[model samples]
Target: MRNMGGEQVEEAVASAVALLRTATERDWETTPAGRLEWTCRYTAEHVAGDLIAYAGQLAGRATKAYVPFEITLDEGTGNEDVLQVIETTGALLAATLRTTPREVRAFHPYPYRSANREGFAALGVAEVFLHTHDIAAGLGLAYEAPAGLCADVLARIFPHVQPGADPWRTLLWATGRGDLPGRAPVTEWRWRNNLVVPAERLTLQGVTPAAATDLAAGGDGGFAWVEGGPFQGTRDAAGMLLKAYGAGVHRPEWGVFVLVRGEDGRAVGGMGFHGPPDEDGRVEIGYDLVEAARGNGYATEGLRALSAWALEREEVTSVFATTDPDNTASQAVIVRAGFARVAGEDSGSAEGAEGAEQFAYELRG
Candidate 1:
């Protein structure tokens, strides 16, 4: 749950610059960057450009698109000057990350239209790490970024990739930079920023595998929780999410989401799918709120938003849930969210429930 911003950007940039400075005299303009057509010099410039651009996004708070400006070196700028540009740009990004509030999100065009501070920081780190490897390979220099740094980057941005024994290698393999045993070669890839679904009073923020791991391990999962928040059920759901991620079957959008109250940005609960939709396009969802946040109807609002989002997807036809027969509050929440009750024998809940008699509910598309 540590913050993955600020000084981390500086560290990544400094590491890359230190290594590249040693080979500044080499013919960077002619040598191609690893697996890319761009020259090593061009690749290095791209890294600096991305760092500055991400910094600009956070600083400008642009929501609809990238800011209409870019960095361009002088025509005669040397390799050493380029390295300086990277250092300067890296400092800007680090400063921006430190100043941006945790709740702020800006434009980033990957799987989502926007990314938070952590997302931009991770992306900047990744650009530095991966491109450094490319330039080193092209220059015949040994290249190995710190494993912890690589792991942090993967957890934040590469949630779709299952963790491997060596984080550095796993990152390379995930982005088609290398290969791994027992997995298909990655010919195409993209880093997915976590999705944020806004509702009237709550925002269901998609839980990344990294957050799930932290939550399962008794941490806050990087969220500021309300007093008496993130109840036992939320922790249990995070454990389930961790398992699903480890098995490489967790679809991020269909996994756990923490419900953050809009007024205070304090997390009140957890809610999301049991897994992806079944063959019948049916997906089971579960949720819970802390004692202090319960009566405010946060659960109902989150369920309504999340269920509506799922049902709108072409792969889902219905959403389902189950509660103890006596848990009338939960039943009311589901009912208010547009779910209808069904007989246990006719409900999908018949297959499971820890052997307790359960009331089933369904919200069909």
Candidate 2:
């Protein structure tokens, strides 16, 4: 996949990008921001723009080591000329990669630049991976990149790949763009893509359905309809996830939430798993009541049923919760769910990348 003298990979990248970029213009008019959101446009522009930047690096331009850019991007008006730009750039990349000698040290804006054909080829793969996702997501289009290309990106850029994978989860985590506990302590999380992302590097965009319900859950109108998850992030949420995941950032680990909506069934509360799986075969209780739904027993009720189901089938040994120490109301809800505080900081709970301190507590049978 790395050797580039011929035009195969370059042509492939060009063809794929052209179609995706074109579709972007057609779809931009409908989004909330009219221009499909500023970031969307910037990302597409960045794809094209970055190539020019890479060209500079390869040509031995005397510039400072290139800092990686994780800015939000979209295909702006200039993308009207995307086809020519792609064809030209793709060919240039193809030519250089194919002819460039093996031992010549070529520079890439990325810190770990190598001039060999394989290095450029890998960069091509990474560019395609990042750019294609922008175009496809921006256009609300379907995308299935060649598995080989994605593999290259994962391999070559593994160290630089940002936190918060699980594109589905990244939606909320990314969208909220909150300060998280610095590098999540590594946890074993199997992603929908079947990639087990390192725990410390997760980012959230939207709460994913699988992250909440069984990845297999489905139905039209049950007593409770499940929504959100990595798979369903096809909406605005997915974009949010992509922007952050594309750049390394922290994402918190938590669980399967069922949105409890209003009479009209608008989501008013969310109930899901919390706490990392413990040595005792237990994960703590986790729930969120939207502002409108708070002051009720909804959290307690949901926890009661969920706890039993988990214990019976999963053989869970215990559960835990950590809330703001001063949030007496939520504390009451947790207490009602049959959990007792195993620890409470006299100074409150631990201060993490999440900004404020949280009071950590646990519940066991």
Candidate 3:
């Protein structure tokens, strides 16, 4: 997967400051920033505040809430001064992203309650891009961000929004800043960071569409995997995830998760649901561990945690799974995770493996 970190943050901030510098002499205090209620000056200040706040969240390793601090520009601060503040905070965020470990995640209350380094980086760049557009629009200055940068942010945070012909415009529309043909106007929106569910020894890190694409294409999906990792089963699941995302039917919470060992921060396997819960509130799940990582109870622990998490949700009544009848190891893992064998099937003279005999299990809420 493409890197989404300090470099992207710096590039976005530099681009924003460079563009806004041309109009520093304009009356920003009196001009409204695009469709927003805030003036250009306030919007610029907001950008700086967000950058510093995100940096603080990671630096402080805050887990329950924001860092309980804010940045403020002194009274009579000129537009140039505001731009400079933005640059400084942007640099601070970039530095934080560089220093933070890939496994480190801090407080960020969106759809989930935390975000990792790449998540913070994406949010910082997004703030710079969207607000810069606002300020530029208010000042009548031309502004456009790199297409790739916009696309990265979209894939990382705005996964629910379908890919449009133009990523920048799609981002603008997704955030209620503009419009797109055939899509309803966005009156309310929230950017989602992928979910991470904690277990005794593993963290089930939710995989994004970008990561799924890479994994499906024979890549690491940006994770440090154990030897013999991401076996064919994992790759097959990733392909399914990519297909769902491409069809615009993927839900982050109901998608694939990489089982990362907390002790070493290395991925041991993949586990996740096939799709969202159906009308009966039942969802099917699947998992596979690398050969070297199997027989360690990692799969059992992951299944238990993930299944419990699913049951906690009001929309989910049960979690289900299936395996080849002869797969005693997997069946043992599922039984250990509290699933009961509910059914069995056999197909005689079928065309493919899908027609083979299988054992089905379920864990009810």
RMSD of each: 1.4, 19.8, 2.0
User: In model 1, what is the error at residue 110, expressed in angstroms?
Assistant: 1.4
Which of the two candidates, 2 or 3, achieves a greater TM-score against the reference? 3
Worst 10 residues of 3 by lDDT: 343-352
In model 1, what lDDT does residue 228 have? 84
Model 3 agreement with the true structure over 238-303: per-residue lDDT tens digits: 888878876778888999999999999999999999899999999988899999998899999999
lDDT of 1 by residue, 1-365 (tens): 86799789999988899899999999999999988888999999999999999999999999999999999999999999999999999999999999998888999999979999999999999999999999999999988988998988888898888888899999999989999999899999998999999899888999888888789889999999999867888889999888977888778988999999888889999998899999999999999998998899899999999999999999999998988877889989999999998775555455355677787889998
* Least well predicted 10-residue stretch by lDDT in candidate 2: 194-203
* lDDT tens digits, residue span 143-221, model 2: 5555544443342333223533343223212323222444443333221211111111111112322222222233211
Q: Positional deviation of 103 in candidate 2, in angstroms?
A: 1.4
Candidate order (lDDT): 3, 1, 2
Off by over 4 Å in 2: 1-8, 21-38, 61-78, 109-117, 159-365
Report the error of model 3 at residue 36, Å: 0.5
Each prediction's total of clashing residue pairs, residues at least 3 apart in sequence or on different chains, is 0, 46, 0
The TM-score that candidate 1 achieves is 0.97
Q: How do all models score by TM-score?
A: 0.97, 0.37, 0.96
Candidate 1 local distance difference test against the native: 0.91
**Alpha-carbon shift of residue 106 in model 1 (angstroms):** 0.8
Q: 1 or 3: which has the higher TM-score? A: 1
Q: What's the candidate order when arranged by decreasing TM-score? A: 1, 3, 2
